[model samples]
Target chain A: MKQLVRTIVLSDSYAQSSQNSPELEERDPYNRLLARQRGIRLPAELIRDNALTVSGLLNPEIGGRSVKPYQPAGYYQHLNFPRRKYAEDLNENQYRRGLYTHWQRTFLHPSMKAFDAPAREECTMVRESSSTPLQALVLLNDPSFVEAAKALAAESEDILDMFERALTRRPTAAEVAVLEELLASEESRFAADAEAVGQLLGVGMKGVSADQRSQLAAKTSVARGILNLQETITRY
Target chain B: MNPYFLDHLKRRTFLENSFTGIGAVALAGLLGRQESLGAPSGIPEAKSGTGILGEKRHRPVKVKRVIHLCMAGGQSHLESFDYKPKLAELDGKPMPASFTKGQQLAQLQKQAGKLKCMGPQFEFTKSGKSGQEISNVFPHLQKVADEIAIIRSMQTEQINHDPAHTFMNTGSIIPGRPSMGAWVNYGIGSEAEDLPGYVVLTSEGGGQGQPISSRQWSSGWLPSQYQGVQFQSKGDAVHYVANPPGVSRDAQGELVDSVNKMNRLFGKTRHDPEIEGRIAQYEMAFKMQASVPGLMDVSAEKPETLERYGCQPGDGSYAANCLLARRLAERGVRFIQLYHRGWDHHGGIKANFEKTANLVDQGTAALIRDLKDRGMLEDTLIIFGGEFGRTPMAQGSGRDHHINAFSMFLCGGGVNGGVTHGATDELGYAAMEDPVHVHDLHATMLHLLGIDHLRLTYRFQGRDFRLTDVFGHLIKPVLA
Candidate 1:
């Protein structure tokens, strides 16, 4: 049994493969060969952890009690027994790993649920992976993701640096073109509306300096696009 | 003949020989473009959003949708719909031992031998043309008694709050069965393109509110897509339905477009079907952002209509949820469940029940009337009940949980209105005549929606599991 375990663990089949093969190629039906790379969307916890790690906002303390990150206001409005108003963790615990997020069985963190995390009412043998609009909504608009994008923007030197930090690779020319256009449009919009800049930067626990608001907001939009890219959240 | 040609000839011969059989015809059509055969007679062609069974159903469809008003904490039948005059006569007297012996009781088990009868806390007057006896606590409901059919002999297996809710919602005491809403949505997919098929809304006030677990709405072994999506009564109806603060609608649209473009570029090289699915989901998410705010905004409703429901829009009360249920029904959400969680009264039954009833009474009646006014009630089934009923025996100022007998009412969706069906014993201790189990209720509900309870089976873990779980008898007499 030990020999079988070691052999399987050490096999070439265990190696990561790229998902860059051309479409419509005939391949193994039962997937006996490694075949074209198939990506597993990271689970809810790791999805958040990846964003925090890349943004340099992750509080890497080994272990403690669960944390409460940025969830929408009144997300637990329907919960009762003893009615509660969600008070998010104000300390560095706010940036803790998703594994440490407080688990409310009735109302699990919305982002976690959107990413198909189980409610923990029953033992989960396997977590189901679904590509859903709710997941897209979480990635695009959830405060946690938005704040991470803002933090990633604040820390990075430029758009290319943000791309490297988020995706672990420099953007292709085509990708760079799309992001640059987004950044330019967003910068002018934020430049005209000072309120918008404050709204964007006011999402997380950290506050932005007065002079850097407009620049940070535009870069945040670029950072957000990079974080939401399919490659950033998938493991091949 | 060549061996390959010989095999082809045999297959063609077999197809010609079994041409009368539907399967053979379908197989032959698949083998070649046999357009002349078309679909077999009596089989409906599949349509989008019609779920697993497609356009075909085991029976003719009666209701297009269901609105379940779940009184989450167990309600007292004695005070609500069942008028137990005999039990009232024995108020403060010792409960008959014959009925108490070997019976399961929740919380009142400690006072087993010392139990006393509690009289109905409210008055039940005969109402409407059919003279259905209803409590004064639900005055608005009494006014519409003619539109409802009351069943006073509803029985369940689980006696505790959580398990009873499980039995009521999933027709099983076990934790992991698909809820009835999930089953209905699975059987008949949603008509609302921008909204989920099954939606849950909850509110609590006036009594001890029990905690409701998300498990009650889970789809179990069924695909997660069928699970009930809970819409918050306050703030955004759906979490993340609103765009982030700095992101305007047009800006968000731009972001969605760029993301989809990147995804499509990725899809050109990779053959993952999930990429395509993600693209579709992104489009749907964009649509939801545009549609949900409009759906939740009840300001367009006339003043009198809002007045009838006794709520300001977005108050997160049961009344507000009832109004929202109507909107959801209009948008064609397949199953809408509203759980009012203030009915778990262990003390102050008289005051608390009245308070909770007031919270739901006008809204419940108003929803029925409003739907009727709009000509939608005929095809909309409305259910109003709780997981179980409170006990007949008194525990301090309130009652314990009872599973043997309870009451619920069905309205619209081809129910024989203004009638009472089934009965509890004289003491209101057990279901005595024409008893309806939780499974029976589920069966009747599916029957109304044109599903054969036995036929709507999902195979999981090498066995065929059904909502009724091998036990359900349609309550035929209640059908219109």
Candidate 2:
């Protein structure tokens, strides 16, 4: 069994290959010889982990009791056996890896379910990968993602830096242009409304000093756009 | 022969053996091509959002939609629809040991030896033209008695709450199977573009609210999209339906547009279909932001309509959910399940059952009447029942869970109203006449929706898994 495992791991097909290679472009169902460079979206746990890892909010510590991160209010409204009210982990556990997130067999965390996490009521052979509006909503509106965006904005120097932090590469000129325009518009909007800025900043446990509120909110918008990119969540 | 064994029959063997083999015959029937004796027709042709079965069904469609009103905890048949005067006369006497000898019992298992008979809690009156005897607690339902077909001999395998709920919903006590709503939605798809195909709404009041898990509506082993999306009556109708605190609607729209643009640009280099799917979902998410809020706003509903349902809009009551079910039916949601989780009456059967009945009776009758009035009754199927029934034997003032017999009702679309099918014994101990098992109910439901229960199978783990799972017989008397 060990020799078989070694042989399988050392196989030529297991070697890393560039996804962009023209040699991998066989379209026929039967005649396809090389593996294509299709990007598989990271599982629900890793998706959350990637966002936190890039934002520098991940606790990095492993092996502990399951944690509860920020979730929408009344997500557990239907849940009863004692009629639970979801209270997120207040300490650093809030930023812990998604692997440690509580697995409620019946009602799983919504954000995780959106990214195709199994309910774990029974053994699952393979996790299904689905793209739906709920996934978009999770990335765009879930407080955990929003909190990660805020943290990413605070740490980055600019939009390009934010892109680098999130996607592991600097954006093209066209991408930078679009983000700069979004940042400028968001800055003006936040400057006009102090309450909106306060709402955006007062998301997670961490708080920024009052002086850099508007600027930070604008950068967060830019950071949010970068984090929400399809490439950011997809593992090539 | 069990269809499960046919998974081992290879295609070459099936073809070479031709028309003589049992494997070929079963395969032909499963593929819905027994008449043709050739390749299955319309195998690849599916309706827009439907799963396997597509537009071509095994039989002619009778109902276009299904709305299951699940009374989550065990609802007693003795008090509700089943009229047993003999049980009332024998009340307070020791129950016949012959009836419950070695029978599965729930909370009353400990007191099995000294079990005392309990009569119907509420008074029964023959109501409507059919003279269907119903409990006085359901006064509103009594008015619409002729519009329903009551089944008194409903039997289930599981006696406990959670597993029985699973059995009632998915036709199996085991988890990880597509729910009834999921199966129906997957078969025909939905007409509502903005809303989900299968929608679940829940409310609780009157008794100890048992936890109705999200698994009740899950599309287990099926594609995730077919799973039921819970629409909360209060707050944001769907989780994350609302934008983040600071983001305006216009800002969110701008962000969506920008994200889609970036996705399209990324697609040029990657050539992955998922990128395009991601782009489409963002647009859908933005559309849901607008549609869901409008859907939840019931202020536009006329005062008379609100009065009929006996609910203030946005109060998160069963009445409001019934109203919403109608709205959802109108918009073409394929399956809508409204779970009222307060029916487990272990102690105070009379008072607790009455309170719970009051919570759902008016709304249930209102929904039936409203649908009939709207001309949607002909194509909409309404199922009202719980997981299982309560015992005839008493546990103090209440009853224990009984698997021998229960009651449920069918109304609207292809149902012979003003009729009672099947019956329990004189003592209301067990189903004596025409017992309707959970699988039979599932089969009949699928039959009404124009699907053959045996044919609508999903192959998983080398076995053809169906809702009925090798068991199911249609309850023919109730069919219109």
Candidate 3:
């Protein structure tokens, strides 16, 4: 069933360009007529996948028990019936797919739920995909994202190369400017509060690779900003 | 980017509501949709201020909203609400063959039929002008005795913790039924724009508190939008409520705007109705970022009021949640379900049950008193009870699960105040007169809320399911 579904969706008719005229835009606002393919924010799983896959860190191992990524402390403390405690994974499991995160019904992992993932208590049919400030917060502050940014920054210092590596496309001029400004501002901010840089670098189970702290911190900031791009979270 | 709305988009919500003037059929049909069947046809992506899109009621109801405090782990009826003077007279006596024979009772002990009858650990006396006999366990609740209608003969099928709670909230011992809160949301819709129609708040006390999951308050077959949102008692108050540490409020706004820019861009490409829906949700969530924090902050409240409710600013106690519930009621949230756990006193009933009673008594009474003081009690229905009640016989030092007869209380809905609805037998073993089943309670609650119990239903697994499950009658005696 899975192979058949994938084969049908992989066909050319399934993937079309959305570059039609404004008239076409108005007439088929929901694209019901199949004029072109529309851009969409990626599903909760792929949002995490795109980050890990771009960096060399994705484990590529499949079919295992769910793993615990970096979540805030006392996140699951409220979960009773013999109160549960979140045990974050420190090994390769931490880099697994978003699907591998521990699925607690009462207390779901904060970042994934922000991306409109249901609590998974029952069969969910049409999952609502919402773009909220919480989602932006997840992209910006969640340790998983921070860790991904640090890993991507370690791959390359050049901004354009980093974008190509993560986004699988060369950076557009406008996108480059957003990244550059974030990098410059974050560098100055972190330089003043070196403790803040230490904090960003201190996110994941694994620590940052040994390098000049200030330079790596700036690069990490740039990578973090790029990862927060609307394009990064969306599928065109 | 434009901070103000584009001329066409400014009144987009107004036009949508005005255009689809079909009333609650539009709202009801929107709140419920099969996932594979897809979102209902012609449902607008976004509406102005996310209140009900005109709920078409069966009739005008006196009770406009509800506040339910679900006492998880059943509260012991014999010790608290139902006072059996005969049981005290016959304390430590073996169960008579007349009551035990031919009756298949729940047994957690090896010698089930030979169990000894236990008397009430606490004293009961008439309280308030109406003279209802409340136990000594709740000193604070005694003051508002006249404001409540106590049901002494409430019955249910489930005797276990999980299933019983399931039955109480969703009207089914089996899982996967839509909760009462969800049904109410689908029926009348929410009034708050920045909050969900059905909001849940859960707290813990010092007994054998059961675990609460999303299932109790889930939307079931209803679309997920109708499901309850459990606001947190600590931290940022809701999931992902706080901005990441370093980002300032302006930066958060910038981030939301930038993200919205792309979402709107994506919407233009697909015209996917979900895109517009997503945009609306993002804006609502953005608005909620400000509103939720404001709602959680109780610093502006008078010190005496906080002291009266026994609520501290940041503590997630039952008192604090009760205070928060009133604030939510004021904001027009359709349903607020607060769950206070640790009521299950299986053994050592005297010592353990008192702790939970004290923990909740003040806050529960204060909620009713506060609502009445604010002139909101007439429109707001408040229910206080557990999933089931405990037996008259002792299990070790505590009581076992008893479903033959239990107790629950109603206040400030359309029910008569200071009234006792039903009666149980002398030994408190069973409801011999005016018995009210779980379904009947559900029916009465729905009737009070302007929904016909049979009329509100969702089809799942080829069977239509309502909160009362086709077996409930309007509890007429309790109604004013």
What lDDT tens digits, residue by residue, belong to model 3 across residues B285-385?
A: 56676688888877788887888898785478888899999999988888999999888888888998999998899999888888998999999888889
Clashing pairs in 1: none
Please identify which of the two predictions, 2 or 3, would achieve the higher lDDT against the true structure.
Answer: 2
Q: In model 1, which regions exceed 4 Å deviation?
A: A1-49, A59-135, A153-236, B1-48, B245-251, B257-283
Arrange candidates, best DockQ first: 1, 2, 3
lDDT, candidate 1, A1-236, per-residue tens: 99998996687765536453422123332233554345678999999999999999999987888889988777677564468877899999999999999988656898998787877755565565555567888899888889899989989999999988977777778878888888888888889988888888998778867567898998888888778877788885
Tens digits of lDDT, candidate 1, B165-231: 9988898887667899878876777788888778899898879878777678876655445667777
Clashes of 3: 2
Total backbone collisions, model 2 = 0
Interface RMSD, Å, model 2: 8.9
Runs off by more than 4 Å, candidate 2: A1-53, A57-135, A157-222, A225-236, B1-48, B245-284
What is each model's TM-score for chain A?
A: 0.92, 0.90, 0.88
Candidate 1 fraction of reference contacts recovered:
0.47
| Interface RMSD for candidate 3 relative to the native interface | 8.3
Error of 1 at B219 (Å): 2.2
How well does chain B match by TM-score in each candidate? Answer: 0.86, 0.87, 0.85
Name the 10 consecutive residues with the lowest summed lDDT in model 1 chain B.
B7-16
